[model samples]
Target: MQPTELMVCTQHAPPIGGAFVVPAPPLPLVPHALKPEILMEAIALLATAVPLALVVALLCATVVCLAAICRAHRTDVVAVVQALPDLALALLRRRRP
Candidate 1:
């Protein structure tokens, strides 16, 4: 092939010492601030959501603590559960007496 033909075939050959102009990418869309009503809605949502989250967190902590206590006294808890029926009967007998 001729040199010019080879140069034309070479995909990456830069224009002979000529500056290449790359167009700048289009600017991204800028986000506008929330309207006052939307901002207040968000605040009100957060106010309710925060307390609900705290309540759920507290319940979860309570469950975890109770589980830990049960685990720590596994045998005792089982014994008490097993004795509940007898204890109820004994309480009934005592009340009658």
Candidate 2:
């Protein structure tokens, strides 16, 4: 039986002192030159939306923190109880054959 050979190919390095890991060209800059009315409407929309979004996010984060704290306490108790058998086994090991 003959072993199969695998081939790998890579891009040739740029002709220079060392290989060039050139990065992609930067994206073209966009001018945010909005019309006066469009700019005012965007500002108004964000002014109203930002506070509402913050309030909702704060409430959700608070709920998640409370739930996580509750789960942590429950897990701590479960871990202590679960460790009892291992503790007992260790204590009983001295008398084992």
lDDT of each: 0.73, 0.71
Q: Give the residue spans of candidate 2 off by over 4 A.
A: 1-33, 74-97
Clashing pairs in 2: none
Q: What C-alpha lDDT, on a 0 to 100 scale, does residue 27 get in candidate 1?
A: 62
Q: Please, what is the TM-score per model?
A: 0.42, 0.40
State the weakest 10-residue window (summed lDDT) of model 2.
1-10
TM-score of 2: 0.40
Q: In candidate 1, what are the lDDT values of residues 1-97, reduced to their tens digit?
A: 2244334342454455563334455565753336677788889999999999999999999999798766777798788789999999999999995
Off by over 4 Å in 1: 1-33, 74-97
Every model: Cα RMSD to truth: 15.8, 22.8
* lDDT score at residue 65, model 1, on the 0-100 scale: 75
Candidate 2: what lDDT? 0.71
Report the number of the highest-TM-score candidate. Answer: 1
